[model samples]
Target: MTRKLLLVLLFLMAVEMNAQKGESNFSLGFNYGFGSEFSNRNYMFTNQFYKVQLYYRLKETKHFQYQILVQPEINFAEHQLLNFYFVKPDTPNYQQKRDEFTRLKDIREYVLNCGFLVRKPIGKTCSFYVLGSIGPMITDTETERMSKGFAFADVLAVGFAASYDKFKFDIRPSVRHVSNAGLGSSNAGYNTKNIEFGISCQL
Candidate 1:
């Protein structure tokens, strides 16, 4: 996990340098998001995320602007299995499986997202943007549907941003998915819908 994080940071630094060479605008943002599982997995799961974002504008037109973004985030989650549908009657230690699955567990995830944003201005102080990102993630707990260790986090969001001079405020609603891409034994993963609030300052 450390190695992966280091590589991602290096990649972001390279992009930042290139953006600087192009005399692009730079911004720093902080965001908070909360959501719950949307998948029909016979389980209850909810998560909260804290993220820091680095943005670099790549191009601009009279009506639209494009930017590249790098975000590092942490997710805190609570999960509990609500049913035994996957456990068969003939399974060994059925009672034990039920006991374990029914208990609530705390999970944590670390993610680094690199993606692009397209923004369209609605007025001088407000705009709307659509974002899509995918990144590597590390899960710190195991669950019935997802395994601990390496996975991928994908996000899609649409947001409104209002600016006051150098400061901007954002409200975004997003969908998130986490899966191992069949690299692990458990791959059912998680799907969630989230709403995020953010504040940023241009540099």
Candidate 2:
């Protein structure tokens, strides 16, 4: 947890440093998403999360801009039992395995994301954007049967943005995918589909 806290502090500090240089292209943002999780069996599990984002972008043209985002998220709720990996009932160890793995329902996650954003202005202060990101993530709760404690993650999102003076806000719908990327033999990976509503202020 200490490393995570340090990362958060460093992220904020970078933004602060940039602001002191008279850069007005930085924005601080917060996002919340509601979505369903789907597993290998084609099931949807209930989950929700909150994200805090820091964004920096440069206007490349009258209608185009480039953006970068550093975001951290805290996930809440838990997956339903129907999505768990379970041993066959016929196996002698089935009951024991089930009991052991069931506790993961209270799992919480820490995710750090960095992304590149592409924007096209609709008109003046309103714009449309698409983004792609890669990052690292860890979960506090999971079956130890899995080898690794962390995995690589990906994010893809599309959103609409509106700028009003020095304040801006947007709504983004996105998908997040996490995979161990061969670090573990069991890389089932996880996916979440959700929408994020965000508000930000220019520095």
Candidate 3:
């Protein structure tokens, strides 16, 4: 009887010690979404592709913390109907060549962003918040020089997330919209949007 009683006491003490250790919170997540860009007052007849994003956050209080993100995208374009005007060169085929050059077959857009996110945990470790960022963007097409270049793209973003936590494991699904204003001169202006669902583990 004494041996059994001692075993129960040891189990209870171990449980109590573990409970007093508190929760160590670290979260990593990923997101992928369908997105497009808005430019020239019209939806460019380009099929926006999916972007892969990664997120990391650390809890400071119960409501606020620090967050960072990395996003990379691949784009496939649809045929566009556009008119091209050119200065008549000292040759006969200047306008003809310009017309052919203006029509593109394929294009790709790449962007890298780094910024901060703010959160308000509603009840538990799950929260909703807005994200804003700034970074550089590069656009390239398989056709001409006027169609491919790198520019500084500013990232202004806002999104919401739902998170589930099981001790050191977490799963989060989120949606966000990112806008590109302009670069120095090569303005590939568009609103890139995405929706992502991902799972992560905290060590």
* Per-residue lDDT of model 2, residues 104-184, tens digit only: 465566788889999999877899989999877776655423334687779899999999997888999989777778687
Candidate 2's error at 30, in angstroms? 1.0
Query: Please, what is the whole-model Cα lDDT of each candidate in the order they appear?
Result: 0.88, 0.72, 0.48
Tell me, by TM-score, which candidate is best.
1
lDDT (Cα, tens digit) per residue for candidate 3, span 88-159 = 375357677556656655666666656677766666656566677666656664222223566544545554
For lDDT, candidate 1 versus 2, the one ahead is 1
lDDT by residue for model 1 (1-203), tens: 64586577567766776866554377879999999988665889999999988787889998999999888999999999887766556657767877887899999999988889999999899999999999999999877788889999999999999999889999999999899999887788889999999999876
What's the best-to-worst order under lDDT? 1, 2, 3
Q: Which pairs of residues have clashing backbones in candidate 2?
A: none
The candidate with the higher lDDT, 2 or 3, is: 2
Model 1 error, position 15 (Å): 12
Evaluated at residue 94, the lDDT of candidate 3 is 61
Tell me how far the alpha carbon of residue 40 in candidate 1 is from the true structure, in angstroms, after superposition.
Answer: 3.7
Q: Give per-residue lDDT, candidate 3, residue 141.
A: 48
Clashes of 3: 3
Candidate 3: residue pairs that collide: 32-196, 33-195, 38-191
